[model samples]
Structures are given as structure tokens and as C-alpha cells.
Target: MSGVDLPGAIRLVRANNVRALDPAPAMFEGMLRGWEQQQRSRLLARKTINDRLSLVRRFAEFTGTYPWDWTPEDVEAYFATRLSRGEVVWSTVRGQQGDLEMFCAFIADRRYGWAKACLEEFGRAPVQVCHDWNTAQHVAEFEGRPGRRAFTYEELQTFFDAADDRVEQIRKKGRKGVLAAWRDSVLVKQFYAYGTRRRETSMLDLSDLRHNPRAPHYGRLGALQIRYGKASRGSPPKRRTVLTVPEVDWIVPVIQEWVEEVRCGFSPGRHPALWVSERCGRLGVRRLDEVFAAIREHADLPAELDLHCLRHTYITHLVEFGYPERFVQEQVGHAYASTTALYTWVSDEYRNRLIEDALQRRLERGGGGTLMPQ
Candidate 1:
């Protein structure tokens, strides 16, 4: 048997009891591989492919059935049990459903022959289980937690001051990690300077620092060439250049100081990461969140104010600085103007000022002194 031709032996065995062989597992594996190949052909990111695969496996495990046996009821019951446990959020459930939908769509597509394979092996095939009835709806432009909002101007000032003070306090005590402290302090400033997501910040390289012709005063730090902007479904990461406008140009000096002085103190053989760790590697996304959390605590800011709040603050301030909506959208690398608007959390004072300016313009136009409710 050990020396027998494997394909011949398999054929002889299948001729006897194909059902006894229980080919469901092997058929499922083939379908998964086909789905992965399809995703790869479509140029989906590796992480995204892995995430979808993991979700499919989890759903199968939950239902005690293979993809061939999955039904809409299984999907609904899985989510129901999850929600009852209070372990997952609506957003997370929505993402899981999206992943499952893509997987099921792949297995059900006749072009892939997964349906034929499943039907021959187990007498059934996978079908789409995710639908609007079992999934969350995108009702509002803002689906984020209610507590997550942009930092106010005063709060932003306090947060920055706290970061700066930490560095100063370390230096005054002749601490060994003053360079690290200085790096964290400047990194937080850079986060606000550019409305960058955490992973986007982590992927920055020295060469990404570019100069904008219109912002000569900012020198080589006038813009950031973001090479790893968020990718759409089945697409590579989107790339964009975020310019340092005059309003946040003050960050130019801070970044210059970090690159010229403090970053140099790190291991010289390290990668060209904008933020490097003491271990001579690029700072990771988790470390970035930890740094922000520490600074936020020291600043006595709201516990709910995560690093994303910095991005919100940037968008809010840019609108207050009178930048055009289109320009803001481009700088933030948002595909739609409405997406950029979602990040903006302008202050009440800014809204009042806008109202005042509107009234002034009306008076200048001699509108018979009509006042309108805002």
C-alpha cells in the first residue's frame, strides 16, 4: 500500500464508498483555496484575505457545519449568540458579515466550480447567508461612538503642553530616555499636524517627507507623501500627498528638530521610519496608541479621547481656518467630501463666527437689515 500509486488507490477506494470517505473537509479546503486564489487575482491585500478566511472558519465552527451546510439561520443565530454575550460591537459584527458575504459569494460563483465540487462531495453547496435582514445598516454619516469627538482648542493645547512638559521633566531629571520622550512628544504633534490614521503614521519613512513649492517656508517638511493610505475593497493601498498648510506650518520646525537632532540619537542602522523605537526598528501601531494614551492621561483629558481624536481635531481646525472643503478632502485623502465632513467636529464658537460673518455679508449687500435664525 505504501508503494501503491496514490491517485490509482484513491480512485479504487472512491469506487467502493465515496460517501464513506466523507469528502466534505477536502471539498471545503478546495473551495477555500479557490476563493483565496480569486481574491489574490483581484489584488486584495494579504491581511484582508486572511481576515476573511478566519471569519469563515469561525462561522463554520460556531454552526458545527461546513460551508456546504451553512444557512441564513446559522448566520443569524451566530450573531444573536454573540450579541447576547455582549462581546462584540455592531461595527465589528458588520465587518464580520461583510467578510462572510465575500467568502460565500466566492464559493457560490459558478465560474469557480465550488458549487459543483460541494454538490458532488456533500450533496449541497454554500449559499449567501448575509443579507440586510441580518446585518447592520449604514443609517448615519457618523456611526462612531458618541463619546468620540474632536478635542477642543483648549483641550488640544493642554494635551500638547502635557507631552512637552513630560519631555522637559525627563530632561530636568537627567533621564536616560529623554530622546525617546522627545520623540513621543514630537510624534503626537505630527499626528495632529497631519490627519493621519495610526497605521499611516507607522508606515512613514524619511523619504515621505517632501517639499511643497507653494510652502517654501516649510522647506523639505512641507508635505507628507503617504504611501499607505487606506485601500478600498480588493485594491492596493491608496497613495496621496498631504501638504503642510500655513495654519499648521508650526509643525515644520518641530519635525525639523526631531529629524535633525533627536532621531539621529537612535541607532544609526535603523530603517528610515519617521518614528523609531529604542530597539532600532520602526515604531509599531500598538506602541503609537500606547504613547498617545500615556500623554492623554498626563494631560488629564477625557479617557475616551483616543489618537483618532487628533485626526478629528486637524479636520475641525482646518475648517475653522477657512480652508476650502475640496482642499481639506484632498489633504485628508478622503474619497468623498462627505467622508471628510464626518471627521469634522467644529466648535460652537466657530459656528457663531460663521453666522456673524454671514450677517456681515448680508449687511454689506444691503439686504434691508433682515436677520434670520441660524
Candidate 2:
């Protein structure tokens, strides 16, 4: 609002005949700078802002046209080409469409002054090219790859056993990584025990473990304060406190052992991170993945089973543990019950047990003596 409008500023430059070999590049640079400034002012994360900008740049490259010349047909053709390549999935296409629409909408907004700038300089302005008719629809709640499922109960046990065995094997061989092996072992245990995402786990500090008034039996480990939770659109990181559920309360001792014994062995006077590297820095998500992947390989799990499968395992196991759906949803910081439901994969044994319980309930109510025909 304080400076001359961007297009007007560009017009003044062109009128001056500064004699640049190519004025278009300069004009485009100015527009991008303005757009990025606007996005940053909205408090979007740097990664998200970059992603949106990249989408716009790719669209321009694909169409070989400026934003002012873009049309809905251009959007359709871009998506058509991406789909034909067989690399983009439905959800990815939908996300790309949404990002493109947001960029176009920003430029097209009258209050933003971009539309006016483009209209005056180029005789046209960018329009919302990605429309409902051309965009991918949100048809299903769960569109994750089919191979990515919760680890079965037996598999979960084997995975943890393998992690523990790594520590023992290192100690037996007089290897150098006994402490590091122990740390990775405990880290994987806490990952599933708490149902935390990689970033959330990476960002956690010792101070994040707090006491729950209702469950004081667990003392300082009664709850986990998640500081780097997944954020909502246009919002900062969301924070939530995941209580130590009765079932996963076993992690209380695991965290206690790490805090009391193993962690103290790390370089003293370091950062107050619960999980620290040998160099006295907080463990990052990439290292966390390597830890899980190594254990998964040793356990002979499928290649598709990644660290995120531990989260899926947590959600599915919670359902089998008979925690209320709403409680499970809240524990995992899901915004919606449907999103939580999407993570659940009930086991055949759990399903059969449920059927048996229903049959017993009917017998107690005197509603049946023999099995009913389907």
C-alpha cells in the first residue's frame, strides 16, 4: 500500500526505456518477489511457501506461458500430462491442484493489486485456472499406499526384540556402538509407544515430558507435551499433550531408564534433549529413520514397512486395546475421527473376539440358544 503498485512500477520502468536486453525477466523477478513477500506475511512455513512457488513455476514451464495467459484448459493439460506419466497419485494431483488454485486466487484477488498490475502491464491478469470441473475430487478418506499397513502383533514383538537384540549383539562383540545401539533401541520403542511422527519425536526435549494430575502414578512421564505437532492450514505448529494410556504405560519405565542411566552417559552440559547423539546434539528424523530401517531389516520385515508403519501400528493396536475411538483420535492429534479411522486396521483375532463377545451377550440376554442363519 505504501509503494507504487507493482505493475505501475513496471510500467514506469518500461516507459523509461532503460534498454535492458530482456525486460520480461526483470518483470517476472519482481512479481515473484512480491508474491513470496505476500506469502511470508501470511505466516506460512518456509517449506510450504517454497512448495507453492515451485508449483507456480512448474505450471509456467509446462504451459510456456505467463500467468496472465494461463487458462483452465492449461491446468487440465498439465494434470493430464502428469497423470499419463503414471508417477502422480490421486491425492498428489489433488494437492497440486489446490496449491495452483491458491496461487492463482491470490493473484486474482482485487485487494492484492496483482490483478491490476498484470491487467495494466499485459492487458490481462491471472485467473483461477484450476476449477472444480477440472480438478481431482476427494473420493476416499484413505488413499495411502496399500502396502503401508500396521505391523501385526507378532511382527511388532519381533521388531522390538530385534532392536533389543542389536544392543546385546553389539555389547557381546565389544563393538563401539553399545551406547548408540541402546539409544536407537529405546528411541524405536518410544516411537510406537507414543504414536509420534518423526518430526514430533525429533523436536522433543526432556522438559516436554510432564506429569498428568489424573495419572500421577507415572510421575514425570505421565504425559508427553508434543510441541511440534502437525499444523493446520495457515497455522503455526499445533501443540497437544498425549497422556500415558494404561496400555502403553510400559514406556514410563523405558523412558525412565534412558533418562536416569543412558542419557546421563552422553556428554554432560549438552542440550536438554531426551534423545541425544554421541556428539551431544538432538537426534534428527533422518537418523531416526536409519535406526528403524536397520532394525526392520534385521527383523526381516517387508521393504514397504517404514517408520510411519509404527504410527499405523500404534493406531491399530489402540483399537485392539479397546480404547474409545475418540480417545485414540485425540491421543494421535488427529483433527477428525474419520482421519483416525483411516489409520485403524483391526486384526482378524480382534474381529473374531468381538463376534464371540456379541454372541455371549445375546446368550446372557436370552435372545438366542442356537446360531442364527445369515
Best by lDDT: 2
Off by over 4 Å in 1: 1-22, 364-374
- lDDT tens per residue, model 2, 259-295: 9999878874658888899888989889999999999
lDDT value for model 1: 0.84
Error of 2 at 89 (Å): 2.5
For model 2, the local distance difference test gives 0.85
- Estimate the Cα RMSD of every predicted model relative to the unseen true structure: 5.4, 3.3
Which 10 residues in a row give candidate 2 its minimum summed lDDT? 7-16
Give the residue spans of candidate 2 off by over 4 A. 1-21, 369-374
lDDT score at residue 150, model 1, on the 0-100 scale: 95
